[model samples]
Target: MAKTDKQIAQEVLDAVGGRDNIASIAHCATRLRIMVHDKEKVNQTEVEDIEKVKGAFYNSGQYQIIFGTGTVNKIYDAITGLGVEGKSNEEVKSEGKKQGNAFQRAIRIFGDVFVPIIPVLVATGLFMGLRGVLMNEQILAWMGMTPKDISPNFILFTQVLTDTAFAFLPALVAWSAFKVFGGSPILGIVLGLMLVNPALPNAYAVGNGSAEALKFFGFIPVVGYQGSVLPAFFVGLIGAKFEKALRKRIPDAIDLIVTPFVTLLVMITLGLFAIGPVFHSLETVILTGTKWVLDLPYGIAGLLIGFFQQIIVVTGVHHIFNFMEIQLLEEFKYNEFNPIISAAMTAQGAATVAVGLKTRNKKLKALALPSAFSAFLGITEPAIFGVNLRYFKPFVCGLIGGAVGGFLASLFHLKASGMAITVLPGTLLFIKDIGQLPIYLLVLAVSFAVGFILTWFFGYSDKMAEELKRAK
Candidate 1:
């Protein structure tokens, strides 16, 4: 018999120590996020066994249960209907931040600030890919047109589509960071504009020696922080604190004018002359180190990253890669990290599919199949937590497949035109070059085969599947 949403909600609440134990509740794309007042009172095993619940785990001081997208929304509503007040996602996130340790909090900050900006980059990436298709020599030749035939105005229009987000990325990062840090977002935006003002030498130009940086105090290098991430983030963080401090001191009568005026003046000075140079240099070193890793011989770099990428995801520190990918795109205008991680995700999904095929239990099959499909679409939490990790061996098999796919990706020097999406949808990122799509398909195919084959033969058995069903 199918469980109603209200029934599932009641069971979940009961499993987690009733209404009093829950401090707040929220829902993300796939999970029911709950901040509980008493962790010891909740029965983790029972929660996992609840009908319609895929899996459960505690992360960043919140008890999260995988309910799979739309299902979670229904469950959250039901939970709220049971006399427990529901909080907004932001409020639950704030509670989580307060409960988490320093490192967890920091990672959460990175996610909070960068997540809002991904859509623009994703749209830009798609635009870049579409433009590549439109301007491809082979395609153009077939159309009886040459590169010279394209008008300058059209090229400029393409630049607007493909380059606008990246050229002014610092502003977006700063604006987001300010919101996350509880400062006035407009002030952050203004300060970020100053970082990339036309008067300063462009960072990319300075990097290529096409333009020299202005010498401030005969030592400080002044350049436009175009496409930079860390500098803008730090400036936003500092600017918000500065603005907040000023708000406390300034009287209400003149506060509006004085606060923004002073905040902008001080932040822009620090951002360009101090914060920008320091963080930008640090960002360069990080980028250099990342490049060095990718450049390791015989695809060792890919092997290590591919093998451990999902492991990092399990630990919840994978958000760090967002900034890394951002930096990679900024420095090289290419994202090598995307293909590697995509292979890892594809492998995990494949392992889940294998599990579904091997399982005789209808319940396990029901969870495993959909979870595997989701993994193919680039969301792996359902596969990772709901199926593969539960079996243990399938997860390891997926890691092995990822390591192989990652090695091939590195060997062929496969790079994506963007970040944020991977696996099936990730194909859009490789559309920039005609040769890139085949290599990407090859990576996915090999990853899927290895993951599926290994998990079928060695990683799972009918006995294990029955055990999982019984345990549930």
Candidate 2:
């Protein structure tokens, strides 16, 4: 029999040499991330040898103990003890500053750079999507109205909030990257300002069109690097390294002044000339390759997206698609590909809702209902953790339904005419351009039906049914 969460927690605490050995603890997805004062005190071999422990790491001056899903919080609670160290400590402390292996460092850096900015991005992205839905000509036409009649100020207010973050994204990335690299954040802000400076010639567009624009310093191309990612990350890394090197080499009296100047010059040069082009080229290659691959049999792309969307969301890599959406919006003035993702989101929500309605266990049903609602609102974490993943069959059902919906939408070339409002039934507003909104609705209906039917049929395995009945 599997150990109870409380038993696992206590055992994990014991393996790590008790609560005193730990400085702090946090959880992400399926791991108990812990900070320790002394790595040697924790028995690494023994911890890994434990039945539930997947791995352990000692890096960035912290020891991390990995556990599978459903066990991290219990272990964290046991380690921290009751009524003393609440969950908020996880947010107050810097988990990324701790040490581990190379992969751990990479994961820490990624989380540090992106996690803080997600809520802002999601809120802004969703707002912009909603504006598009409200403003689309077809949507207004269907409602017996016109865009010209809408108040200009109201439109501008919405547009400003939606576009501000994107327009100034390089600054955000630079700030976050600086934090990731352990550098002075002000320097990152300066670098970000230079990227979006209006005076800089647009190197990105120069070769394709204009030939008369003057170059920066007559050698380096003055590319408008707004929203650039790799440039800031690479530059921040170089800056941190240079600062550290300067501190060690210079006399103590002159260290501060010299270190800052030397690091600034080196980092700026590296960012503008080397990192900028390399990142641009890499992004180009990846986008081209993805487009080519996705152009293959439609079913293949649909299958891939359906199966991995939730997994990607869990790992926080879904921002990659958010990046793609921004790129498409900049280049094409709108996006059509996002609707496929919307279909998958809807399917997941439908499955969770079905499970909530069908399950007899009150606790499970309570968990599933809230998760379903969150998923419908374009927040899938609750659903992934609480409903779909708990009963694996629901997740599978959702994936199959999503794939079918995606294929049909692609077959009819049913692009997202505009962004959805809240990823709920409100997204149906974008279907006005399909010329047959009812057909689009029919596809979503079928997807929901599939999820509901499949969950009802296959979700209640013998073991689960027995456990659920007992719980009830």
Candidate 3:
């Protein structure tokens, strides 16, 4: 019989030295963020040796243990149950002093807020890409060849599946922000829903939109907070601080009712008057800056997209780029400059494929093959954490290879006719008016060749050989 999720999580917790060793804990789609008092206390090698564990990394004082799908929450619960004492209230207070300036804090906050939702975004993105294949080819249309050929039911289903995540993104952000700020996530979600509620008048709405629009004391204006990033983030931050303050002042008697009432009143006022406009301005500035940056030298954009793409995937911040892509697609109707993204995706897949082909370790090779295939299918985390990153040389080779490919694509002005990465195999979609297929192919070829050769040449290390021997 398969071990229950809790059982596996408990085993992992015990292997990592129980709850007492952990200083903090969080999770993403496929990894558990374990901050321990002493990193050495967590037997990372032993943790990786576990069947459920995929890989481990020590970065920014966090011991990240990667797992397969559906395992992170289980592992998180078990880790929490281990009676590990989180940093005390005092420790948290002192830690705030160590944080950098506003700009750095903002960047850190953005990373924290965006990284956790990547897996679901990728899964949904892949589904959206595949849906295009089904719909565009007349597969559904053929089934009903009536006057209105396209099946409304199929259209509706696909539309909902593809757009639901984007439409309700604010709520998701609110949940993440709440957790990050150490507030009641459920309450944050409720507040987020209220902000996004379609029935309510959106202050951001230009004309007479709704009479019951969100207002501060029935006067101050507030925008529709759905699909927004900054507003919910600020609200969540204030909400957490308010929760902490209320906890301190309110006595045990009627503390729940009194504290909640006070926090809600303060948070709503602040959200409407202060947090909303500040975040709105910030969002506008970011969007403007991104536009300016992208309009610079094509080579610079290419280099950035190529280098940062893989790094973003490793850190799980690639979804931020995905969000940008969606906004671009919606605004422009087609993404002309996204070939760089395609090249990066191809590079990651190619590197992992190379690892599978070249590695001597049977178990490592086993991990590599499936992960490479997944990367090729546009799911890169498995490949990134499982294969390419494990072999440092291949990862570097892939980055350089991707940059070269991106530069070539830019040089030839190759453009993607659609917003999907699935256009890779169908090179016809990438052919621009300038007859750039040859250059495009050459770039892709070089990227693949470089990745393969680098992996084969540098992969057969002593540790890997030993691992292979042990597996045998």
- Candidate achieving the largest lDDT: 1
Tens digits of per-residue lDDT for model 1, 1-472: 9889999999998999999999999899989989998999999778877887887877766888988769999999998999889988878878888765678678888988999999888888888888988889998999999999999999999999988898899999999999988899987888788889999999889989999999988999899999999999999999998899999999999998999999998999888888998999899899999999999989888889999999988877689999999888877778998899989999999999999988886767888999899899998888998888877899999999999999989988998988898999999999999899999999999999999999999999879756865885
Best by TM-score: 1
lDDT of 3 by residue, 1-472 (tens): 8676677777777777877776667776677766666656777556766666766775434566777568776766665665654443335423432344554445556656666765555455555555655555354456654435567897888788766665566667677787877887876776667666776555335324434445666776666664566777778778887887788888989887887777777876677677876886686676666656565675777766766777866653344664455444433333434667667766777777777766676667777777767765556666776666765666777787677767766656565444445325535344322245566667677666665666567643546656753764
The collision pairs in model 1 are none
By summed lDDT, the worst window of 10 consecutive residues in model 2 runs over: 83-92
Give the winner by TM-score: 2 or 3.
Answer: 2
Candidate 2, residue 410: how far the Cα is off, in Å: 3.8
Model 1 residue 201 CA deviation (Å) reads: 1.3
For all candidates, the clash counts are 0, 7, 2
Better of 1 and 2 by lDDT: 1
Off by over 4 Å in 1: 1-4, 465-472
- Per-prediction CA RMSD (Å): 1.9, 7.3, 8.3
Measured against the true structure, the TM-scores of the candidates, in listed sequence, are 0.95, 0.69, 0.61
Model 2: lDDT of residue 101: 58
